[model samples]
Every structure is written in C-alpha cells, then in structure tokens.
Target: MIARKFWVLALGILMIGFSSSVTAEVPEIGQKAPDFRLSTPDGHPVRLSEFTAKGTVVLVVLRGFPGYQCPYCQKQVHDFLLNGDKFAAAGAEVLLVYPGPPADLDQHAKEFLAKQNPLPANVHLVVDPDYAFTNQYGLRWDAPHETAYPSTFLIDGQGAVFFRKVSREHGDRTTAADVLGELERDKAAHAH
Candidate 1:
C-alpha cells in the first residue's frame, strides 16, 4: 500500500510539473510583447509588430463565441469604442482579439460586432482561430464553455509592454478611461 501511494504521488507531481511547464507566462511590464499575425474578418492579415512599429498598441483579448456571445465582452468593446477619439488622439491602435474554434469563427465575430457601431479607423478586430493566439499569450481559459481570459496590454512604439491586465473572471475588465490615463502617464514618463 505504501509503495502504491508513493507511485501515485510521484505521477501526480510529474503531471503537475508538466502542465505548469506547458503554460506560458503573461508578458510583464518592460518585456517585449509577443508578435502574432491574425486575420481580420475581411481576410486582411494584422500583425502586432506592424502596429507597434507605428505607435502604441492596445491588445485586447475578448471571450469570443463561447457557446454564446459574452455580454461583458460586448460592453467592454462598446466602452472602448466610445473612447475611440481619445485612443486615436493618443496614437494608440486598438487590436481586439476574438478567439474561438476555426469553424464559423468569422461569422461569430461578425455577429459579435453587429450590435456595436462601426469600428473606428484606429480599432481593428482580429480572429484567433482555435485559440492559437490565446495560448501563445497565456490567456486561454481552457474551461468548458469558456474562451480566452479577457486581457488588455499596452505596448509602446518600441514593442515593450508598459501595462497589462488579465482578468480571470468575465466582468472585471480594464476600462477605456483607465487605459487612456495609462497612456498619458506613459507619455509623460517617456518625455522625461
């Protein structure tokens, strides 16, 4: 019995270690943001590095079509849209990541955007097929009936992450006002 218990504990430990090793860590402030290319609904490829090359990038990972459209995600997107002018003035490009299975992903993205007004020129919605981008950024929720964890990252022109917020729950999301304030602070800090 003692030997059997020891083997079970060892197997459990090994499994835990393996799982932790596979999970990616969230990019910290001052770390270079991971570059990824995902397609817009109309098939244009959007690359993170390209956006960062021009100016600041607000990378938002939304809970996309997880059996149903997430209301919180909609509200968050709407909030950002309401602040479109401010974001544009700050020279920040908002990249909204809608992630799900490859099948019907674009259709779902369209459905999600249907309720909102047309996206501002500064905002771009990209699809993450089969959670590739989510896993790459360590934001995959990996639970039944769940999608990627809602996250927001602020990357400066240099491609370095200056701010980030990852929400484990659906409702607690970073607000547009919060991000705009961060942008102002970041700009002031850089000036000095």
Candidate 2:
C-alpha cells in the first residue's frame, strides 16, 4: 500500500527527467552503468562507482529546473522518501541525480528536500554537475520547456544494467511496484 505511492513519485520524477531534454539514447541494458561523483544537498557526496559496487543500484535521473518549480518533480521526491523501507527491503541503493547547470544544482536540491520529508538514509541525492553523468548515460534532454527527461535504471551488484525505462513525456514509465517486481524476479532467478 505505502510502497505504491513512493514508486509513483519516483516514476513522476523519471517521466520529467525523460521528457525534459532531448538526448541521444544512452548505453543500453547489460552494459556497465556509467559512474560519477556529485555534490548532494544533504552536504555529502554520492559516487556512482562506489555505490554500484556495493548492491543493486536504482538510479533515478531528475531534470533540475529550479526556475520552473515542477510540481510533478516535487511529488517524486516525496514518494521515494516515503517508501524508503520497501527500497531497503529489496537491497537496492537509490541515487537521484540532480542534473543541470552547476549553479542550479544546489538550489533545486534544497527545494526538493524542502517540499518533501528528509530522504531516507538509503537514498542519495547527488548533483550531476553540468550533466556529466547524464551525458555519459546518454539520457540528456535538449528540448525547450524541459531540461532532461525522466529515466530509471536498475544496475545489479556487479554494475551491469538489468532494467531501464526512459519516459518520453510527463507520465508513464517505471513504478515502485515494477521495480520491486523486478528485484524479486531477479532474486528468485538467482536462487535457482
């Protein structure tokens, strides 16, 4: 029940991330997930390589537009924060990449946090700093009224992408249930 809402928030963020900018398609699944280290509003830094090596990593790429104040984006942050338990139960690490100009990164992060409760310890809100990570993954959006489209990628413990969804508009894409379902399916498969 509670899990559904959090995932919707995440999916909304992904939808916005995917629909925001026009970027060439990024590295596809079964490939090594690109890595980066970015400043987080939480005053800590999130390094991708460091995380990917640890556990299953769920990367939620967000379009950082502190100027527009996307209500959808706001909800996404809240959703994830609310469902921290479900994510941890699945042994997943979630990283929210705040992508945009470096100047706007901090402001947007602060606004995101302000609009929602504190991020669960398991979730890391990292800055993309000029869209470094976004470009590497080929998930950048180069359109107007949008900065970067919403996208979600699930990387396994070995750093290989297993699942990914890039939203083309403001709605539809990965959801919390979808993610948990994937994790459970993969875990069951591994058990065999």
Candidate 3:
C-alpha cells in the first residue's frame, strides 16, 4: 500500500509539471514582445520587427471564421476604424491579426473586410495561417467554433510590451481609446 501511494504521488507531481510546461504565458509588461512574420491578404509579409523599428505597434488578435464571421470581432474592428486617424496621429501602426484554419483563411479574411470601410493606410489586416501567430503569442482558443482568444498588445519602438489584454470570451476586447491612452502615457513616461 505504501508503494502504491508513492507511485500515485509521483504521477500527480509529474502531471502537474507537464501541464505547467505546456501552457504558454502572455508576455508581461516590459518583456520583449515576440516577433512574428505574417502576411496580408494581398500576400505582403508584415514583420513585427519592421513595425517596431519605426514606431509603436498595436497588435490585435481576432477570431477568424470560426465556422462563421464573428460579430464581436466585426464590432471591435469597426471601433478601431472609427479612430484610425487618432491612432495614426499618435504614430502607431495598428496590426489586426485574423487567425483561423489555414484552409480558405484568406477568403474568409477578405469577406470580413468586405463588411467594413476601407481600412486606413496605417491599419493593416494580416492573416494568421493555421493559428501560428496565435499559438506563438499564447492566444489560441483551442475549442469548438473558436479560432483565437481576442487579445491586444501595445509594443513600443524597441519591442517592449507596454500594455496587454487577453479576453477569454467574445467581448471585453481592448478598444482604440484604451490603446491610445496607453500610448500617451508611455510617451509621457519616456519623455522624462
């Protein structure tokens, strides 16, 4: 009986360690944001480092074609579109990441864009093929009818994360105003 108990304890500990190692943590504030290279629907490669090299980057991960277009994602994109000028005026590049299965992902992203106004020049919509970028950023939803957890991160010119928000559900996503506020705060902080 003592040997059996010892085996059970060992198994439990092993399981705990394995699970912890498998889960990826979101990059914390001040941590270097993970650099990624994803493509726009038109096949242009958008590299995170290139954007960070110039100015602040607002990275937004969206649910893409989880069997159907996500209304919440649409709303969030619309909100950002409304404030496009503000984001550009702040010298920030807004990168919208649409993650889904690789199959026909580009068509779905195009359809999603069809429903919205022409994206501002400073705002670019990039596709995350097969959830590669999502998984790298630890935002994959990994469930039925889900592509990725809605997430937003503010990375400065040096690639340091200044703000982050990951929403488990459909709503509760970070807004343009929220990111703009963070940019102002970061700028002021660095001015000193």
Compared with the true structure, all predictions reach lDDT values of 0.93, 0.77, 0.91
Regions of model 2 farther than 4 Å from truth: 1-25
lDDT of 1 by residue, 1-192 (tens): 999999999999999999877977889999999899999987999999999999999999999888888999999999999999999999999999999888898998998998664899999999997777898888989899898999999999999999999999999999999999999999999899
TM-scores, one per candidate: 0.88, 0.81, 0.87
RMSD, every candidate, angstroms: 5.4, 15.1, 5.3
lDDT by residue for model 2 (62-159), tens? 77673566676656766776777999988888888777767756777777677565668788887776777777678777677566678888999888
Best by TM-score: 1
User: In model 1, how large is the Cα lDDT of residue 55?
Assistant: 96
Off by over 4 Å in 3: 1-21
Candidate 1 wrong stretches, greater than 4 Å? 1-21
Model 2 Cα displacement at 30 (Å)? Answer: 0.9
Give lDDT tens digits, candidate 3, residues 1-192. Answer: 999999999999999999867866688999999999999988999999999999999999898779899999999999999999999999999999998888888988999999674889999999987777887788889899998899999999999998999999999988888888998998899899
Residue 135 CA displacement from its true place in model 2, Å:
1.0
Q: Once model 3 is optimally superposed onto the true structure by TM-score, how far is the C-alpha of residue 48 displaced, in angstroms? A: 0.3
